[model samples]
Target: MSLKRFLDRADESRRSLLVANRSSPDPILNVLEATFDDQPVRVSERAVPDVETDTVLLVEDGEVLATSPLSALRDTIVTVNSDLYRTGAMGIDDLDMPAVLERLDDVRFTLRGYPKSNTEKLLLVVVSRYIEGIAWQAGHGRHRASFQYLSRIKDERGTRRVYERLAETDVDVHVYGRPDWVPSERFDVTTHVGHDADFRDSWVVLFRPRPPTPDANAPDSPSTDHDPVALLAIETEPHVWEGFWTFDQSLVADLDAYVAREL
Candidate 1:
């Protein structure tokens, strides 16, 4: 299946974030609403005591799925910018993402990168790094990521350091993009170069946990509890993209297989 089709396969459910008993300033809530403007998520504030003051609750179908301190949400999401990621100012180890952020998985989104506006693309960038951080922690998964152009790997210091560190691990790291720049010997990744439309217009980051031993009773067998995760985005126009991230094990496995077989 195509990347666009994968995005289309997202579940049709919607989610809401209720800033309950918020003692935070109005600007913080405003930023939260603006960040999710075009997505399927609804952000609102209330004065009810259903939750503690200064906390945000993620609800779907009238059930509270997850909650995080409003201050933590502000620190993790609202007050960030794209430069911290692109400029290598914020490393993967420095990411302390709130649980509410991770709970956004499976929701489809539309964002704009760079020259259009700053806030929209930060969400995707955050999710991309979060997936990378998971792979880094697992240390033995097969990770695949794509940049529209290969030069980004060499040009962005933070991006370069991230791949370098992953290569240092046992993880089989694979990168896809247009061959704008060749990686140095320090980068131990398998490079897949192409000039096709997919190479020029897609952003993907995926991590599939190492396969478990057939014999579960073996002492040396690894745990199979780790689930596969992925993020897929396709540029529909210059600077504008539509995408989604998921933690569904089967879907991640299928997407990983598709990438291995094609593009």
Candidate 2:
């Protein structure tokens, strides 16, 4: 099936954000709502006893899946901009996503960038970097990412640095894009070049960690228990995209398999 089909499949699942015990001002709630505007998520507020003030909860089908401090979310997510990533101002190590945001895995999202709006696309960028950071830390996973055009790898300082670092590690790095620019040998990543629709419209970052060996006993070794992570998006129109990020191992495996066998 196509990448768009995967996004369509993910749309069947839904989640909401509940801002419980919010003692914060209206502006704070407004920002929270604005962050999720036009996305699949519904953000609501209510007062619940025993819950800390300004705590944000991720709820699915009336069950609270995870929670995070509203202040922490505001500082980490709400206040950020796309330039911080484009200019390499924020390193991958600097992205400390809150649990609530991390819990957004499996949620489908539609976002617009640049001339359409400034903030809508920032969330996807953040998630992409977060996945990259995970692969970097794991050190031995397989990372496959797409850039629409190979030139972007060199044009975006942060992105170039990220690939450079990933290449230095044992991670099996693969990059897909249009063949507008060829990467130098120093990058050391397997290049998948194409001029097809998938290369032009898809945005995918997937990391599949190698399973731990039975005799492996290093306490500091990156935990093999970590789930495979993937972010898949397809540009539906100029500057607009629809997609989802997932931590589900089965789905991640399916996605990786598709990429390996097809794209």
Candidate 3:
């Protein structure tokens, strides 16, 4: 469903105020501009003075370093910790506000935090991961039979279990990539040849395989090794989209143009 529908449903239940502590040019504000331009929700530039509202969207840093005081956030504290993108683990220590976490059940909380180095990257990662997580949750519950990935399907370092589980569950997989590379029994696949001809030039070259050296005992070829971390969605939902968009309207316009051309 679209973000407007989500907000419309939430409105039927309780009042919500989009409390944004930071000023303009913030990613959260971009979200408000994109989807809620017509909505009548209140926007605040200060800490929540009261907790009378049913839901609260406290968008700020996780503040794991205690850079700011927690006194302002006296109740129902909900924070997003995205440190896993850098480190291989969740920022559990960031949620160390004992008093706040004690009332975690009292807070209508959701943590869609996984690491991305920058905001632009984080936005795309969030959207992609959110849809995939929905599909995975369905698979676990035996709800939705399958979902399609509109990108290349490669046997990367960490996705073996994902493919295995989907195969075991008989989930219908559709992929838009090299048909020969992926078997038909595994995925309903399509090869997009000569589609977006410049796409290949934009890929970051990380490694290249080489033939064995003349001397059998020669050292292995030089290569780039990256962190083997995978992005995970820890309780993301559709409603969260209502609070995020590109930091600039130009980026949104570019996305619109691309979606018009490709989607």
Candidate 4:
């Protein structure tokens, strides 16, 4: 009975969460799968210097909220947004916090590409001006078999909550730190994607929880008594066989079960 309720709630949450800005689906390329039945041969990275062979573009942004700093990210195959779009919105210096929060909650943020190098970290410094509140997000391009298999129904924010709890039980669990990102950093954060960040044949993507800020009525009140935490991360991978899945079905099942039990 509890499992049924959990599933229902998860579905409803997925629908409601993307209510305002769910129209568009802009995903970065994460997988590199190729097939040639004729020649029966194709090229893929992995031997070494895989990241270098994959010539990809990145989009990044930084924002400074009340008393906190944050940086948002998106990486894609093609370049998105010119220099002006990224440099303009350094931090909410003059915008109304109430209005800004409302805009963010609505998910109207435009994709500006993901961070590729440490150089972009300079833009994060702008967050120093804000009074409080911080949140950062990023979308790794392409889908590997490992990443795409994650829970589809959960929002980015919910994923954070899931990971945090799982950390108690799982090993090598590296989640978002800095107590909610930091100032003068590409993403206000740097989640450890495990020691072996290999997602070639599979898919890997990341999401973060929505930033918690004071409400219009209560300027100091936030969603929780404490700060936000990076929780769950869902990943999807392809199947090895023509129709069979390539990822560890047991692990994927565990993730599904975990979400069912928790959120």
Candidate 5:
């Protein structure tokens, strides 16, 4: 569903505020633009309105962040700099918070804190993970479960039973370059099996013999014979490769499949 519809079902309380305004607007008046210590926040020119009237709390990254007035934030501009995108750069491949926050200037975040009296404070988050990539399959069109609960299906590593299945079937399953984002664990992450074209953050799925040609029900669609090729929702950069490792690193793991399955 669209963001608007999602927000409609988000919550009822509109007590908290999320002054989600980004970029530079007009200078502030009474709210002095604090020097270095206290960063200044700006109010937009237009007023925000809500069909339903109620105090709502705002939250982000599983934390109570701010309280917002639904109607006061229509076209209001919020002043911010680096304090915006603070999602710690754990081990992520890309850390484009600055660019993202700048581009998504219109989007707003929820805010919340304590309750006025009886109402219980409600927290809500508006995070998302987009998926738009193709998966590489073995020549036999199947493999064991290797990426079980993988935090990011796109960034697969270490040997898995799936590869063992490919070996048992004697099929070549490989997707070149890094894969697009996929469902992993609970959050989202990048993959190393698919690619667009340029061959930067590409993924690869490699095995013996070439992958079988696609038949009916293939991701590429009615036009069968779609061998293992890069499947991107968008056109990618041009690329070419010579050969890859034929050996599978997960042979030993797959040896005890029956016993493992019992677990």
Candidate 6:
């Protein structure tokens, strides 16, 4: 059945419940699935045939996942990030952070295009800033120095180089969300249980979580005309560049505070 029909059915039930893609494991879908899990919400799946037909809540994409719905349902929120409409608007390019860092010389590097994977590029920018910060402090005769990094997710190879470079410098490093595999002496570590925090002016990288696997016992949801995979790229952009971090007050504030107090 069409999504509109589903929503219409839901309206008749007079419930505040929401629906999500059941069969697709897209990040947004997963978020909704998790949010509504065990709650009295409905879901649409492509893997198994939906047994609930009559009075079924029909849902449309914009009605559930986009701005209009959220605005209508929630109170006003102060946002430091980009506007909702601007999300996923940036196109993918061919930039690579590791290569840029290799060529970096105290001078700035130019972007030829956005890379297919910009995670490394984002790391390069942050590490470069840390390097610059350390140099500035040393020149001013500051005996103590440190750079703090707050990462929402872990990246081994990309961050390894960052840790190594900082380790060689005069600056001490503190990493939030450090993984178990990372050595202790490499940098100081801290724990942050908050949902969000601030960082200094730097780059950012974004990622989409992999979808969950289908259950063998669950009903098979028929595939619709909508393509879930196509939306993944756009959803993962804000977390991958130097300029992007400027918009995140949490990251910028935290990094600035650490520098002021520690270094």
TM-score of each: 0.94, 0.92, 0.32, 0.19, 0.17, 0.25
Error of 4 at 233 (Å): 11
What is the per-residue lDDT of model 4 for residues 1-263, given as tens digits with 9 covering 90 to 100? 22122111211110010111111223222111111111111212222232222222111132222111111112111122323223433222332222211222211111111243222211111111121122221111111112221332122343333333233331222222212332223212224222222222212111222335568898576653222211122112222211111123343344344432332
Off by over 4 Å in 1: 214-222
Task: Please give, for residues 1-263, the per-residue lDDT of candidate 3 as tens digits.
Answer: 21122112121212233443443345544443332233332234444454333223533233321122332232112123223322323221222332222211111222222232122233323333333333343332111111122222344322333344444542233222222353455443223322332222111101011222365465765432211111111123322222221113243333323322442
User: Residue 242 deviation, candidate 3, in Å?
Assistant: 16
**By lDDT, is 1 or 3 better?**
1
lDDT of 5 by residue, 1-263 (tens): 11122122222221222333323333431121221011112222222364133222243443434443332222122232111212211111122122112222113222221332111101110111000001123334322222212333333331222232234443323222333434333321222332223234222221222344566776673432322221111112222111111122242123223212321
Q: Rate the local accuracy (lDDT) of all candidates.
A: 0.86, 0.86, 0.28, 0.22, 0.24, 0.27
True-vs-predicted CA distance for residue 64, candidate 2, Å: 1.0
- Per candidate, the number of residue pairs that clash is 0, 0, 1, 54, 45, 34
- Over 4 Å off in model 5, which ranges? 1-159, 178-197, 201-263
The 10-residue segment of model 6 with minimum total lDDT is 226-235
Preferred candidate (TM-score higher): 2 or 4: 2
Q: Between the candidate structures 2 and 6, which one is better when assessed by lDDT?
A: 2
Model 2 stretches with alpha carbons more than 4 Å out: 216-223
Cα lDDT tens digits for candidate 1, 1-263:
46677877666789998899988889999998988887789999888755689988899999988998998778766888877877878888888777777888888888887888667888888888888888888888799999989999888888888888899998899999999898877779999999877788889999998986677677676666667899999999999988888999888888888888888
Model 6, 170-254: lDDT tens per residue? 4333443222334544353333221222233222221111234466777973332211100000112343221111213343334
Give the clashing residue pairs of candidate 2, or none: none
Better TM-score candidate (2, 3): 2
